[model samples]
Target: MSPVRRRALVVTLPFALAWAVVLAVFTGLRDRLPDPLATHFGPGGEADGFTGPGAFLSVASAVLIGSGLLIALGVLRTRTALRAQRPVVAIGYGTAGLLGYAFASVLFANADAVRASRVSEPVWQLGVAFGVACATGALGWLIAGRDTAPEDDPEGSAAPARLPLADGEVATWTRTVGSPVLLFGGVVAVLVGAVLAAVGPGVQAWLIVIGLISAAPARCRVTVDRRGLTVAPWFAPWPRKRIPLARIERATSGAANALSLGGWGYRITGRGSALVFRSGDALFLRLATGREFAVTVDDAATAAALLNALIERERGTSEQRG
Candidate 1:
């Protein structure tokens, strides 16, 4: 089976089915449930917080569906080594089991409660949830079996993008790139926080903080010179990431989506690591360790070409010495 479809089947189906069953049971007990369901528990297990049934259902759906899609799509998009794919598949099943057990436990605890405050949960049930999660995760791992690793570029190596450079010639290319989507999301979050302030000041405060952080665009200066590639934040250049020319197998340019690269910021995925801040043109580096590193930026083609030329020059100098 194709790896993408295999991962989708192994993860998505179980996750969807688990949530579907939980929702179904919750609906079946609607008549028995109070208008406001007990959503939180005290130390002694008495209910401490409440939420409207409709609102609770809405939040549940959003969490389940949103997270499930992200997981499924993430697995499908990136190519993975067999070793990395194993844990990803297992975690997928375990997550579904954990979420399903927790949600269903709440419904059963709140069943037929005269008042939200009177609801109680046997804390032991939390242990059961973990047990169930472990079993399901193990099953997923077993089902994953042994899959072959993904294939790389043909011709035994990537054909590096090149720009002609003469002896002693030096070139440096730099660009500052930022994510508009992050800015948009931050604005929306702040607006939502304002609305939530009426309900709970404590929660609204955190939401506002998160919105501010998200809204602030992150800019990085991408530089390619004889020293290879360097990425430094616009705010501070002291802390920067660099890829040495000796470790780079090849450099190329391609269009990369932020989500497919595992969202904004430095993230590790089954395929490789990425410095994702936006979704657009990106410089792709295949390293000697068989892992790829990518940086999203404008004018990536120029940067990639410069890197290829520099790497070739370094190789020629090394060959003559040998």
Candidate 2:
């Protein structure tokens, strides 16, 4: 194992120990907890749900253990597989810490409540908890730092050669892609609404909003013209992306994977952001700000080549003017 990986593991050790301590403390105090613990609290800081102490502890333990193991496994796998795993490991450890602290605080608070025979207001300061976790993770990542440079994608050279255009020529291309994310999100929202309805009627109003978002058309129109690249859903006018030619540093065509982009649908990955609809070749852009952006669409090779040509042409025009 590399020295960096060793450091990462060491940095995460304290958090794991913290989890263990919290679990042990809560278990020792289990006998002191009330018969039916106030498991859920409402907005007004009142008990809304009750569960046996055993069930609560069981669920908490399972979530904590499962999540911690998954994150640790992720760090190990990513460290072995990718050159840059600092961000991934850091975020994972930080999130684990955040969850551990949150659960521990909850358990302790409820125990106190049971002993005192009084309702427990939510004592966890979500902002502070999250902030501390994120800070710790960021620190670990900074300490671990970048281990190696990212390897070149073997298939990146497969992009089509830049198209040739005349000095005054203006080119345009158009393609449409289906966005299944809305459909999927819509289905999930409807299911959630059904579950919420069973719990209470107050959540019914949010169902309408979810329904509208889901029912919207799933087609996105992608256009590349003299005005640069424009991507917008066919059904919406205001929500669109217009990347001007000047801001684009480079364009390439490559296969996109949901796992790499962390589950797709306008995802923000460590490298940059992606607007992915399906897994296939996509037009990737390196912006002047050194950020990467991508959009998955059909015939990405042609788009990438044309985009390169256009960028060169724009720069050429400016050079001639000077």
Which residue pairs come into collision in candidate 1? none
lDDT of each: 0.76, 0.67
TM-score of each: 0.71, 0.66
Worst 10 residues of 1 by lDDT: 151-160
Global Cα RMSD, each model: 4.9, 5.5
Q: Which TM-score value belongs to model 2?
A: 0.66
Error of 2 at 286 (Å): 3.1
Residue 320 in candidate 2, Cα distance off native in Å: 7.2
Candidate 1 residue 297 Cα shift, in angstroms, is 3.9
| Per-residue lDDT of candidate 2, residues 1-322 (tens digit) | 6753664465456457657866786787787677677655556556655677778767776766665664454344332323344555566558767777766666666774644335565544666678869887876576546545343351364654588888778789889988676576767677767776677534555875775565453578888887778888786765788899999887888776443444435667667777777666688888899988888888888888888899988898889899
lDDT of 1 by residue, 7-105 (tens): 666668767877797899788999999979987665567676688998888777776777688677766665543344556667777888888888888
Error of 2 at 238 (Å): 3.1
